[model samples]
Target chain A: MITYDDEVVCAPRAGTLYDVLELILDRGMVIDVFVRVSLVGIEILKVDARIVVASVDTYLRFAEACNRLDLEHDVRSKTVPEMFGSPVAKTVGRAGARRTARSLTDKVRDVLAPEHEEAAEAEARTRERAERPRSRPAARPRGEDDRPRSRPRRRTETEDE
Target chain B: MTAPTTTAPESAPESAPESAAAPKALYVYGIAPAGIRTPRSRGVDGAPVRLLTEAGLCAAVSAAPPRLRPRRRDLLAHQAVLDELAEQGPVLPMRFAVLSPRTDTLLTQLRSDAAHLTQQLDGVRGCVELNVKGTVVPGHFADLVRRDDRLRTLALQTRRRPDYEANVRLGEAIALGVRREARRAAREVVDRLAPLAVRTVQGATDDEQVLSASFLLRSADEARFREAVAERARACGDRLALSVTGPLPCYSFVDPRPASPAGR
Candidate 1:
């Protein structure tokens, strides 16, 4: 006779993509012989994800939430439930903190969601090209060569070491 | 950045010329000993998955994807494949986007590395990885302000003055106090839980997330482990919010090599 609340509280939560991002990206076996493609924008994504944690904006939000506390109330009575009961205090605390948290979530969402509109447009262009097969040798070989050149010489140099 | 265009005609040639040239490389998910059933989960880019057996081990892989990105669906697909494999037996999961240059290289690597890989797999068999993360709850700031005279005085001064500068100072102090308490609780949680695990690996933590650790535990002990976590979560609920993820594949516990032959 397990209660629903017990099940809710005790069950292990399914991990989200954000939860396992470090594991998939940073951990696991990579043999020396394999070439790890330099993923574009990965550095930006990692930095952006952690940026909100220590920002001055976050500090100010904490202060604002603390300011809403009713200092005159008896300290023992000021439990988390009581704090939740005050709509004004709850709203103020959430409003200040939510902005930074929301922005971080949005950044993660943008990084993870495939760019469907852009993919569709690219597909249309490819379809058009396929329809006119004899127009030109595809400009792709040059692009592939350019991709390898764009990789910094320094990265390969370090791998040699 | 936008997704890389993967439709290049030149992309085909590089993967095409090798013997058995299938116009695709193998996107490896993990390596397990021969005889486990193939995973039903879709592979990255929605390719159907199959196992390639050599020596005594089999590598679970899909047709190499044309340009890999950290798209949400693909990441989940990678995890799903490993998760299904882990259910059957021990698996050595590859990092995301590890492509074997050719089928020969993959088969050769498997044959040569079979002993090392099998020993590593045996080490993690019947165990699971449990990742615990804790973030500051921020609800305890009221108690913090009440307990410390310095913080109390600062709050009183801010209330009296109520200027932007005063408020900022007050806020910074409260933020520091909250983070300090959360970190302390995080240490206590780890201390209590680490003994339950065979190995503990700490992950990066910041001002917001005070605890990020993965624990490897025997499957039989998972219930007791969860009970311990729930108890700790209750004990520190006001100051820290803790979440447990897994009974997952032992991502953190696997050794890069099972000790050098000469212990190098």
Candidate 2:
């Protein structure tokens, strides 16, 4: 079994607009007479948000983490505590295992922040969170300190398709 | 942002290119019983919102913004209006970007659909929607590697071969295994929580988001529901990460023409 901070992992976040975007956009009522205007970049927003993990990129990353593991050890004798203490744990932890484990809200934040600099900054922040021994998802709901103060423009508005 | 023209304008001329921005058009936010205090929340494009009451039902509306885009602020405003209305009484939230061509047209629809809309509103009275989303957590790699013989064998082979193809194969297997575990945990979560809700609606799920479901819960039961979610989050924190988002307006439960029951 894997061990981590329950406070960080188990606490339910208050919902932000991003958390309920699907509900706002897709689930509400529509009168046949009233027009539902077609949005310019919303298709891309919706599509990018629902990305699946079954890809060569994900597979390669997983294989890379597995290669760094200590598979030569006797599985029967090895225990959870020893596994956690081993260099194997550090290898897997550092090798994008946490990256694969990111929550959907984090991906939505990345997709919404389209500026290259902002995206890179967001990436660095995500890495920082991943490297922490126990940390919450990178994007907190609306009023958190996770977003950089410098991000003024709504970059997601400019995305095409 | 380029303005997207309305798909089919009921009364606008074919020659008119910008009918959507016409001053006569009203952006409809939601419907509720008449006489609830007007929502103080701003509408899309920062327009002030008001109610157009007809046939005992009223819609929260505003002069349609000249240009409509799904900007973050506008979306929040739309939700805020419905949320405020929901606090007062049952509300039927319109999907974002719904625009009525004219006040008369909106009033006609309100009159025609009052019985159905009121019934729909009653279904969700005193209840709130709570959405639960669960994602895969690959934190159990050590445990998985130990328990699965095939995965262990692949890990061993990849270490020896150390080739690109071999790594991809090993990694693909691991990803699949991790997703499968998370999916199982997601099912267990829904099964555990569904009983606490009056009704449940399952949303689309992909490999990464193993589960996304909304529960229409009574206001009094919201605490019990949240406690149940917290317990499940603790139970499966290793394999799946769960987050709850709501007490929101009942967006998923407001369909007048309800979809066939799919949630189990």
Candidate 3:
């Protein structure tokens, strides 16, 4: 069973920037005369968001979660809530983090969070100063429960695979 | 996993030439029917946005920021301008980062393609785009194991031997079964929700995200659509987690065909 907060996911909210990122970048009318800016970071962002590599780590995590399940008892009799202290959900949740795949989701959460742009902008500035390989956002360790429940919404079917 | 190297630093040099140009470039937000109020929202680069009118249509534009980057502030600003325009009537939101080299070029395109653009705008006039996405919920692993003989046998076998390789196989099978169930739930979601919208457009999907769809919904039907989505969320909460974001400018429904063949 999904958490009550997860159930609240159905409520419609105004589209955040990440929610409509694909629409803003990919869709919409473009007159031939207009210059579509060749955005540099955006290509990497799109590529990062889509590549869900089925790595050994993900398989191992899944196996660990499955090992905890009570296969002997019929699952139909007892719902998901009774299963191994939410291990499967936690595994599935962390599955998004496979091989830096979490960056997009982290970015999405960062964007969707109600906190203002100054924090994100400042973080971006610091990252620029560091000139480090794209590091994870500083915003990650905050209580995950505090994240405004927004679904991961991609707006195109095109694949790089 | 490399950090975004080209963040704010690269933007400064790029905008230098744009600022030096004779006729300043205009960053376009969107095109709407003539005479909506100039959007009060701060535009890209914090420039004030104004509408450029021609051919009975007005385009919301701002002096292109000398150094344009897809910064969070600017992207939100672009959407804000279009959202304001969309509130009043139909608007063809421009793709982000579309810059008119000069005001005249934009005016010329608007004049030449006004008829086709207007027709396209009319198609989405009373409608709004609501995007619904559903991700796989491995919360149902127990249920999946119960239902699938292969998964159940593997789970039992792995529990008995409990070795590294055996555990991996059992886990991979469960993951596969979870995705299969989620995909089926995702399909059921679209089937139930599609009938309520004027048009449905499917988006990308992978193992984790089973469904991403945009429904072109009439403004009035927005509530009903949400209701249907809520019901689906409850029914499939075990397998899929669904969320809706919109009443947005109809981005998907527009640009289905070239606005003007000659312009292409």
Candidate 4:
């Protein structure tokens, strides 16, 4: 029932380095002989990628976002991370990051209640194809007009990649 | 950006070296076993990756001349080539932007390190790599809050006395609660899938997505494993967005060196 596009947005992920850093770096063959190429940016890359999830700021932000929801609706307000376009979850400014998350939480409701999203997606996809040809999973894959660029969204390399 | 690391899609005819006699550098991707299909495309660098097949081994190599530095295209080129090769068989993927002094050095690597390479290939022979990604599912937070009386009490109490700081605190608590739920689901996914794997490799993690481990499974177990993934997907639909990648050649599973006597 899931098309590549649906799967693109929802499928269980497959094997990629991003998915197996432990197996490759920690578990796989580490021959002491062959010079393990001292990659320049690898350590930093790994460090940045695995930023700890627990932060007071995060808690405050979560609290902030939760405040906007219906307490009795039983609809758990989705965290912004759910709105991520790519695997990378880089929240640069704390305040903006929290607001952006509303979209993702909002999406959960839309996904579960599909009729509207189907129409929205059809329209979104057409508009998407017209503008940005490379709209990746990157967030904010739009143009200068702030009109929501298409495919190739910007995945982070800053606090995230 | 194209999810598959595809930057440029070129018809990789000869792979870099054959185009040579010139000094243009070729970007290197990962290495796959010999006889597996060459990727349907080229390295993100736009160079063709020629296979220098040796005794049961093939290096998915491209030419890299001097003055070559890592560019986004080149890194993506490297990823794309390996992605292509991985579709067929096990690949010993090089890190992004690895350049040899010349094709001669790479060949020398293949020639001298032939035994090591073969052993590396054999290590991943009957295995496939599967990547699992877990992202936080926001909807789960409400479920958690409702289920946990303690959290519900806190939510009600916070609602009654709502203030800027209080709301932030409540939201933060809820966020923490949601993340905990997500992390738990992530663990469950790993534990359940681990049984089907020969070995597992974990990648670094970040906040939004848990780009965790790859399970190297027995080729036969792939189906069962996929079935399990579907089950997991359905079961944990709202807690975590679980996406599975590949029956790929053991790119992450293969060793870079020849096995030592002890390792053997």
> What TM-score does each of the candidates earn?
0.74, 0.73, 0.75, 0.61
Q: Write the per-residue lDDT of candidate 4 for residues A1-161, one digit (tens) a residue.
A: 23232222322333233433443334333333222334566565455335454556556545544444345754323233232221222221110111122233433333334444445544544554565333112232212322222432332322222
DockQ of 1: 0.13
RMSD of 1: 18.6
Residue B161 lDDT in model 3? 90
Q: Is the docking of candidate 1 incorrect, acceptable, medium or high quality?
A: incorrect
TM-score of chain A of each: 0.39, 0.39, 0.42, 0.35
What clash pairs does model 1 have? Answer: A63-B171
**For residue A69, what is the lDDT in candidate 4?**
39
Model 4 CAPRI quality: incorrect
Identify the runs in model 1 with alpha carbons over 4 angstroms from their true place. Answer: A1-14, A47-51, A55-57, A68-77, A80-161, B1-24, B257-264
Q: Give the per-residue lDDT digits (tens) of candidate 2, residues B163-258.
A: 888988887888889889889989999999999999999998888778889999998888788778767765665567676777788889988333
lDDT of 4 by residue, B1-264 (tens): 222222222222244564433323334555556788767566543656677676667767664422334343454455566667766766676655454434444555666677776767677766777766666655445456667787777778877898767766676677677777778877888888888888876665555565356788877787677677656654554556666666544656665444443221
lDDT of 2 at B120: 89
Candidate 1 structure, TM-score to reference: 0.74
TM-score top scorer: 3
* Model 3 per-residue lDDT tens digits across residues A1-161: 22222333433234555567777778887777777788878887666556553456556656765665556654223233223222223323322211124533543343224235446444544554364322122112223432323433433322222
* Predicted candidate 3 versus true structure: per-residue lDDT over B7-35, tens digit per residue: 23222223324342335577888999998
Model 3 - which docking category? Answer: incorrect
lDDT scores of the candidates, listed in order? 0.64, 0.67, 0.67, 0.52
Worst 10 residues of 1 chain B by lDDT: B1-10
Report clashes for each candidate as comma-separated counts.
Answer: 1, 1, 7, 46
Candidate DockQ scores, in order: 0.13, 0.26, 0.22, 0.14
